[model samples]
Target chain A: MNGVFAKLRTGLAAAALASTALAGPVSAQQVKEFWHYLGAGGELEGVEGMMEVAKSKIDEEFTHRVVPGGSAGLRQQVQVSLMGGVPPMAYQVSAGLELNQLAQSGRLVPLTEAWEQINGDEIFPEGLIQVISYGDEKYGLPFAMSMLGNTWYNKGIFEELGLEVPTTWEEWDEVATTLEENGYVALTSGGGSAAWTIYQFYAALFDAAGADGYWEFVGGMMPLDDPRFVEAVDLFEAHFVKYFDDEWTGGVWSDGLDRLMAGEVAMYNMGDWASGYMRQRGWTPNEEYSFFPAPSLQNVTIFQSDVIVVLKGEETDLGMKFAAAAASPEAQQAFNAAKGSIAPSNEIDPSFYDPIAKMEYDKLVSEDAIVLPNLYVLMPSGFKEDLGNAFTRFGATKDRAAFDEELARLEEMRKEMYEAGEFGTF
Target chain B: MTTLNPLAAIPFRQRDRMTYFIFLMVPAVLYVAAYIYPTIETFRLSFFEWDGFSPPEYIGLENYWELLGEPRFRNAFFNNLKWLVFYLTLPTVTGLALALLLDAELRGSVVFRTIFFIPFTITTVAVASAWRWMYKPSNGVMTQFVEALGFDAPNWLGDPSINTYSIMGAALWAWSGFTFLIYFGGLRALPTELIEAARIDGAKFWTILFKIKLPLLWPSTIVVLGIAAVDSMKIFDLVWAMTQGGPYRSSSVLAVEMYETSFVMFKLGQGAAVAFVLLVVASIVVMPYIYHMTRQVDEVKE
Candidate 1:
């Protein structure tokens, strides 16, 4: 009986090997190439890891290529290629009204059917899903979600000063005062890069006032002349002028992180990806360093989601299949596990996350915080251009009344865009 | 020689004329195909609204209208003017002075000339990158030196008002060398008899330089000015590498603006319009100088 069993096992193994050999040679599945703007070391590693998994488990014959560059370079190159009529199969894009524009232009393949078939709506956060969906049709899949409105601080410094993490605007001011008095730079950030750092200040202000109301004002759904919006803007300007670095005007985001890591600064306002840098420098989360939502912002968190959009191509079916694979729970887990971001799909277990990441992930899942849409994404082309100019002027000039005037102009432009049916109503 | 008809008096045979036409036409046609055609195409594109990916929609002069209205474009245009004016004047003055000084018979003058020209040999990107590091507030050598001297270092690249100036300093460093070489060559060709006559007239050294040498060097100065003017008007790489037109739109020049509009903003028509505007502006500024210089050359020959 033992000899018979051994012979049967060997026969089955031989048959399996024979069948595998009879399978078509490699390069059977059409190759789908992608380009991305994820040039940071950790993000590149995460992408490579995902590629490895995809190659091993998914269509073995298919190939995945990644060309990485800085955001500006990638945006320029992608624009050139698309306008020249040679867009890649897949590319990294932010989810928002800009994406909606892309969809309307018919450059992107409508993934509504695939999304419905895969039940993507049920897995992704509703706000995120809504951001990527335009005209009641899905165009992309979310890959990573960021916790954008978080303050990262040196735990050692806070402990030395005997100050607890604050959870309110008043408390945050006190902490800033204490840190300043103690000969530490209270906060460090750069506004030179299109006023992105100012976003944190605005997010906090919006939180303190009211997130929904703030969005309505910025989106021009509410009157820009509203005194509440002015108050929020005033508060934002005050903190921006007060607690930021001495060279705030010249600062870059990477420089801020470097200062915090080098112990030259006390705290920084940044996204969760910052944790990856801290971890790389031999610091453990919640011990050497800790992060909390910007206390002054109330419960409003500014989040940005990374979404994958499939371009219209010859291999549309294969591209959709790969996109679906990218959206699968297994892919999300593998990607987010390496990426230090929350899996876009809610089905992934939060327990598998690192302790600090898990905390932010849990808060996002529970609170369902509002995702702030950048004006560039939400407004029409002309309006967005005008608004970008206005925002730059406002940030540089720091004249509140002038800023208000710009906001008014932006509101008028938004109204015109809406009237012209350029954008859907909120 | 036998008396020949006026038509036959021409130097070339009919066959030679055909060969000459072919020879000239080949290079001229190539130049037009490679350079002129693309420029014309880009100018044509300015009249059409296209994102570059899709087919362009004909929208005559709309891009130019929008560009004129856009405040950022205005700022960039003004910045380009500022760059051209300052860049042309400062470098030519410095280079001419240096070339005059080095033209004198002095010890180790060859070494001095080599040292002066060294910066120009370095790549523009490298020069920009090095300056960026030096201007860095945290780890820059200049910042550390300034801090050590018990002074606060201003954000060189951060301040909108001074950012272009800071980039100009780097550009001038690269440019002064080229001007020096041109002035050096001109000095070498100066008429010794004229200088001796000026000295005999009891003219002081300053008067000699201003009156005689300068007038003699006018041809070289014009050439240098023309090159520098064109270069400064089209300056892109150093500013892009250094400031990326940041700290608000303070450092933005027309070239950077054009690139951002065409590529970053994906407004190809607007970019094309900006490019054409830049071309016209550059032509307007340069043509008179070129004409005057050519006339000066003719006067010198006479």
Candidate 2:
């Protein structure tokens, strides 16, 4: 009788397994494609990870696919792909030109219904919402938010060097000089093919240009002949050039943060993703590494955010569901904690973040913190490349001749593009 | 069921025509659709201003007009020209030398040939990574070797003046194996009697290489140079992976510039113009080699 019972139990278990296998494909026939820049071993793994967790919350019988690509590469790919009449359900794009152009093309589904689905106005700050929206329509869901002017350092290195958090230009210079004197690379910052690698200097330029000048400088309203612009360039030379490592010119932004984590350098200037990357690499935050808001501009926040845009199609329902889940307090908290970035939803409590991210996030929400867009985020991409070429020359040698000539060329191009109506009054 | 041939009802001559037409249709259509059409469309697009959005506008030759005075475009073009010169010389010479060395019947010749051919087997991405690490600042293999020899090494990828050559060195390292394999195959087909006759005449190895082998290797030389020249124009992956045409656009090539303009800058019209110019340059390069090869083939047939 016992042997008979065992055989019956085994048959029942096999029957259950077969039924589940039969039901999976039937249920998963409906699916959504989520395109993002996981970029192989990045701090943004949370974007994909939380998508997996959010799958359970997706009430529809829809499966999801994560399509990985780099930021700029994905933009180009999406451009070409959409030209072919097939686009992924959603993709990672920055707020400025990428979103603006895509929105203009009528390829994206505006977030009217999706924003309502996600509870956007209640959770996200107006600044973030403004960043992701254009033409008064929300077009994307913000996943990663950074107060872009934070400086990351090896806490152990700082303790060993007896360095304190620097607040002024003079103090920062002295601290950097001491680190260099002791056998440390005072700083590490680099850029690759993209429009990054100039942001670190942009932060300093912010301080040099002051609050009003910085805003005007980024907005194309600032004159090319502004003495403050020249001072800003000089400030970049004094801070970034003086302490740069030998390998600073040809790498992506992450390389510097990686070096900081490796303790080969004393300091780095980037967004809060540094802490996330450190955690991903098994470093305990505030122990192995630490971060501080970029000095002399604590009142100003240079913001960086990555957003997902829903494409209009039969799968819009599933895509909107994914976007809504991404904006949920639980999902945002889980994702941002893992990503080393702050949740886009401002309602998330500060305690959910690590010390570095919390401090940065608190400022982003603080009454006195003023939001400024980095050139990489706000400027037109063609304008960005023109600036990139000029910055490369400006970075190596602060040659006034080359600087002035490039500046003139840029202004001319901007004038032509503006007259042609390329910038579109944004 | 019996299979039937529609051409069976026709005369043999007409059937032959029909068979040939059917056989050639797919590829001919493909060539027109994939290659010829796009090339021609690019020319048309070059005259218009299009941002991949909105309707394209007729901008006359404004895109081409911008290039005449653009310093960055000039830098990229001249850099490509430098690559053209480098590819025509280094890989061919090094490859010819290695092929001659390995064309012997010595023991372990296969091992030597394999060792020399290994770099070509590795993909360009992996090879670029290896070379980039080898050229890393202050602590890389090349940097350390220079330092040991009592010299301060410039950052290979950071210095504008030297970065292109540094990238070319990596390209040549991977490409030499390919050139060697091509020459080795050519050498295998050479008449052994010529080598034996020279050796019997007390000819030195240098004389044998320069006079008999190299003179006979003319066909291979033309083909190899043409391949390298055309391949050199499309040199983007190595530069993109290694330096990204950087340290100040000193290493920027036409392809990288075209990519940035079209994709990053969204000036598809201008990017099309750059592509057109590169296409013209590539054609100018390959045309002479084709003429030379065809002439050689005719002489052989005669």
Candidate 3:
């Protein structure tokens, strides 16, 4: 009688196991793990809200891990894990060569099918797709877009000085001179990270010269000795020397921001994302601070977006599904609204955006600004190192002649990279 | 009597010998496997070019050749040499002198000894961070103090020429305590009778220190010098936490350069190569001291 009862129990267990197997693919009801580098207080809260909403919509248990890192740290961790045959289900990556590197390493799953299934090809902006896609393969889904051409300022200081937002390079100089005359540091800049603050100068210059002309000269389509490139370098160096604070050489990006917030400096050129920091410090847009498109240098603004890539691993199918869900219009609206950025998916209502972000987005869309790939992403790693060295030299010397010499050397390096086909074929 | 049962007697001695060998060799074997094997692997890895992710490609001596030619690497190597010379000598000398002073029958000697050794109690990261803030150009305490004294405060970290020296000043503060402790113990262990005899022979204090104390403190000197040399060669934490080998890589040491090349640049092979070169240089500097010490130990035992 005991043997017969044991056999009955085993039969019931097997039937239950078979039933689960027949259910066909782990449903959205299963637990999913997500990794991100959003460790900042506001950003972390925003991500948690999005995750909560995602879990509510899907039948799955959501587990989100906040990876403590910046871009380099995240990349190193992800790359090491991926190469070692273990990778996170999903993680955020910058759109471009970072995505390309993952794809080449066979650590990224193609998301073309996922995009089609979700109708992302229609909802997402073509420009954003172009940025995140490699060849015929899609490795990431864009969630938020950042505007890189905004110059934030202390509104109180500007109003007291009766300085209007400058629209051209000459006017910018006048404003800087006026501010300096009034005992305010004209501009706050930091060279600690080399490329972070310098990108503003590079983008402004690229815009002024016309996209084609800038690329032909600075991008090594033409010789480094081109007079136009030298002129641009001189202009960039002159502005850097004339306007930036004396202590800028040792200051980090956050320090410059702190100086601006403390009213020690009148203005700083940075990305739209910098507003998040200001908001966190209890400064509201159009009240304590205001931002405008950077003046002069051809009025061109370069844009970029942050993307989420599904790392290929044991749970790749689940990872791809999670990334797709994260990229959906509903998810984009929830995430970008809380995080203070524009959604890459055009389906989201503009009314959901904050006043500052809406204004930046409208301007960017209407002007059809050029999206210049970050130099670090566009150039080979070695070339990026050389470029950083050159920038360091330029910052230290504050010499137009030296800047031009460095630009010439950079041109040579870019040419070598182009010939080697290091930057992927356009 | 042994011939009656030589085999039986041999087994007993063999058992004792086996136990002795285990006692002596186990700890050393574990230590070498844990430490020395990894170090040798790091050297071997120097010959390959890898990004730590991709499969490592054998690049022969290309990395070494490039390192020899690269201006940044050369600057770091030369700076390391400067650190070894200045950092090793200045702190050791000052520490020995302080130790000698304390060894004398001075009032509150214990308090003075504790006070002098306080800097070593602070962690390297904390010391470096404090010093970095102090050396800040505009608002730093050092800058403020200098300006109060009616002098301009040069950019201690920003200026490439002075950055390494500034970092060294911070290092010296943390290191002097350690050397002082070693020397203090050495001075305390000296035979009192010999010193008393030298004083009775009309030897002056300075003459006694040079003629008697220093010679007897040879063992301590060798140990201190060896430790200081090795520590200076492998210096990383303070430099990393303070300047990050920056102000245009002026403060870069071999360790920092190796890290940047391997992790930041994703060039692991080159990083390993730099590390190996650093090891070779360190061995060249330290092996002779180690050999001499070993020989001295043998002589003392004999």
Best by lDDT: 2
- Model 2: per-residue lDDT, tens digit, B88-157? 9999999988998888877899998999899999999999999988887746799899999999987788
Docking band of candidate 2:
incorrect
Per-residue CA lDDT of candidate 1, range A1-426, in tens? 999999989966775454333221221222366567665665767666666665665563445445554544666666655544455667777776657766776767888887987698687776677678877788887777777768899888899999988887778889989999999888876544553554565564464457566556445565555677567666666665467665645656667777887777888887777888888888898898988877644445466777778777666666676677777777777778877888878787777698888887777667645555443355455565555555555555566677777787777767776667765333
TM-scores, all candidates, are 0.85, 0.89, 0.86
**Candidate 3's residue-wise lDDT over B198-279, tens digit each?**
9999999999999999999988888889988898789888877777777567888999898778777777778888888898
Candidate 2, residues A297-415: lDDT per residue as tens digits?
67777777778788776677778778777777777777777666777787676686777777777777788877765656666767767787677666656565787888887888777
Ranking by TM-score: 2, 3, 1
Best of the two (2, 3) by TM-score: 2
As a whole number from 0 to 100, the lDDT of residue B53 in candidate 2 is 47
| C-alpha lDDT of residue B300 in model 3 | 94
**Candidate 2 residue runs with Cα over 4 Å from true position:** A1-31, A39-45, A48-58, A113-122, A193-197, A250-254, A261-263, A314-322, A424-426, B1-6, B104-107, B299-302
The lDDT ranking, best first, is 2, 1, 3
Candidate 3 docking quality: incorrect, acceptable, medium or high: incorrect
Highest TM-score model number: 2
- Kindly list the per-residue Cα lDDT of model 1 for residues B103-212, writing each as its tens digit: 98678999989988989999999999888878887778877988899998777888777878888888888888989999999999998999889889898999989999
Model 3: share of native contacts present?
0.21
* lDDT of every predicted structure (CA atoms): 0.74, 0.76, 0.73
TM-score of chain A of each: 0.82, 0.82, 0.84
lDDT of 3 by residue, A1-426 (tens): 999999978965775454333221222222247777877775677677667666666675557777675766776776555434445778888776556655665556799888887787777655456656777988888777776757889998899999998887788889899999998888866545545545656644564465666444333365556666556566666665567666765545666677788887898877777787888788988888888767652334455677878765566777777777777777878888888877777677788877788777666555555545444454456666666666665666666676676667667777777786655432
